[model samples]
Target: MANTSNKVREFQRKLYLRSKQEPDQAFYSLYDKICRFDILWDAFYLCKANKGAAGVDGVRFEDLNSIETSGKLIKTLRAELVEGRYRPLPVKRVQIPKDNGKTRNLGIPSIRDRIVQMACTLVLSPVFEPHFHCNSYGYRPKRSAQDAVICINGYLKQGYQQVYDADLSKFFDTIPHSRLLDKVRSKVTDRAVLRLIKLFLKAPISEPTAKGKSRIVGNPIGTPQGGVISPLLANIYLNDFCRKIATKTPCKIISYADDFVILSKTPFNSAQQDWIKNELEQEGLKLNEDKTHIVDMTQVGNEFDFLGFTFKYIVGFIQHTNYVKIYPSKKSQKKYKDKLRSIVKHRTSLTLDQLVERVNRVVRGWKNYFGKVGYPRQVFFKMDWFLVARFYRWSRSRSQRRSLYLAQDAWNKLHKAGLVYLQPTKMKTAKVSR
Candidate 1:
């Protein structure tokens, strides 16, 4: 362990000297530099300190953080990377329940695996970030689902005729391992790092069965869904796909990870879909036919949901002139209501104040998100009323014969006390002129 520490210190000193000599270059130019003991330790510390979970190995962050074992652990990790003896443990598969009575499978990697992956990402992402399309928002810093929605909204407001929403079917799971490696290799030349990533990609997965047994299965294709490095790799792999669509077509592509919304002045024809299908097939990816939809944004009453914002072209009279109002969708209202109801249902054990606090948190965040995109004032009012009714029901169930006034009084009290605040009614609208 002492010898490993000395070697790590020497590597750091050499890195510092090289940086001084170059002066303009980024520190640690080569991929092998990422395998240094201190770098791995720092990466491991960051992951463990942030409460990163364990994988199928059952090695917890706390175990890695232990003073008695951390040195040995770091030493072993360094040796594994340097000697190319690293083999990723099986991913722990868990199913998370979604809103639509469906389950999303998430793959949890062990802390050790996450540390190595994160270290590689720390080195590789900077090289990849500048190359990603400006329209692609998935997994990029300072870019988000809302940003994708905003970009699409901007194009629509600028008179784009239609929006075609498409998502890849089992995107992470279907990405061809060899193809992804080829893409990564095209940009990153670090042999050791590449080998480690290969191990992660080809690692078998342990899926939990309904009968409480675990099944170990080989995953020949696709990266693990929930692994730390998965999103970055997915972004890199799809960067070309996005570039191809952007360069060959007039349509603008806005991607928040695998979810893609193509904006154009004309509707997508079968030929365009076929082209996209063929492009995706080349990389061993396919579109989810069930989730794909094409909506003409120029036509009145036409609407589509993307990145949680429902965009619709509503014709309205503004000072005797008919103009289209591209506003947040009604579906957003229903979604928010369902979310509030779910919160109320699950948090019944909380006190009235605690419950109000929780509700306010959700309301504030939801309002901030949709509010930024010009969600209607009426929707905010509807949300407040829904909450009022929910509060009344909660009060009624707790105390027999609690009057409507009592519930209303409590609602008003929460607002007055600043425990809860409704979204403002006079928010600005992003209406487009015809």
Candidate 2:
């Protein structure tokens, strides 16, 4: 009976906190009952219950309408509630939350923005420019391939060239918050956070929504936008590096945000590589040496895959592997070959299934024609066969959904012949219908 009494009291206290109302004897009793188990989740449940307690009793709804200090606090509270950060003291009602549409708010500008905007515009503009991501992967590579050709053309005009690839070391974490906030102050006109920042030093911090809740320790990651000046700050850092390197002669440096590639026409000799390495070290960015490769332009092909496109140091000589293995394990070989044939048929509306009886036949044939010029995966011996089937489906035409297999057969014949030479012409349309 004594144990039961203690339990009841603990539950009442927890319930009181959760309710967000003034602590009363009854609430304390409930709070006492809950803490007995000593489980951590019970603490969260208690916190959730306490969220309902925030109140404004004497202040009437009409008083809240006035656009003054109280009104701003209320607005901030409302915003917090919508963000799932606000909790009233415990309440009995369980209801699904609704999204109250609010216009997006960009915060005040800071020194960070000023710095970044200036750098990208002034220092980096001469060399690397922002590149846009294409919508579709299919046509994108071919276009990017063309762009590589243009880069090669530029190199030839300038002289001989060497390329070095780089990535930043903890780029985002190094930004200064106070400097960032300077930018935020100008952009953010939101009634709440702005007001908070304005009177921050003097303001009484409401008890943290829960114990141990504190400000974020490091810079945030993976957000589209931040308080106001994050992008400007980031771009400024990029520009700073660009400006320093601008003075360096006889080489070209290009960057897409942090991923950078440096090109110089000098020979792939040790002196040129060492010179380029020292220049990058002067800036904050570091090159990932293991992934980096020096392409010899004089060799068979200079083409390599970077950021996605297969950039041939030469263009036509470089080959890419397709997903399906022209020769998989003995068990899956037939299946893999069939799928590749399906994709080829779908491409040109002609079937070549009759010309190939085994995986070896298809493997030997496509390599002879396309070589390194196939899809992202190679149909090489002992490769994953299931990938080939997937590629066939992915490459199939959206219009041919109704008769995919039939379309595949048709595509293969045209692909092989490079012309509309469908053998057994009457049977072609017949196979499609069935």
- Residue 105, model 2: Cα distance from true site in angstroms: 25
| Residue 35 lDDT (model 1) | 75
Q: lDDT per residue, candidate 1, 1-434, as tens digits?
A: 11224555465456445544653444324556667666777667667655745689898866654676878877787788778787888999888887678888888988878878877775566666766888999887678777787777778778776777887888887888888988877766566667778888988889988899999999888888888889899898999989998999998988987888888887789998888889888888888888887887766777777766667667675554333444456666677788778877634788767777777888888867777655456666767667766766766677767444543455466566455546454222222111
lDDT of 1: 0.73
Count of backbone collisions within predicted model 2: 81
Q: Candidate 1: lDDT of 13? A: 54
After superposition, the stretches of candidate 1 with alpha carbons farther than 4 Å from their true spots are 1-29, 41-54, 59-76, 319-339, 407-409, 412-418, 422-434
Q: Please identify model 2 stretches exceeding 4 Å from their true place.
A: 1-153, 156-160, 174-216, 220-231, 268-279, 315-434
- TM-score for all predictions? 0.82, 0.35
Q: What is the C-alpha RMSD of each candidate to the true structure, in Å?
A: 7.1, 22.7
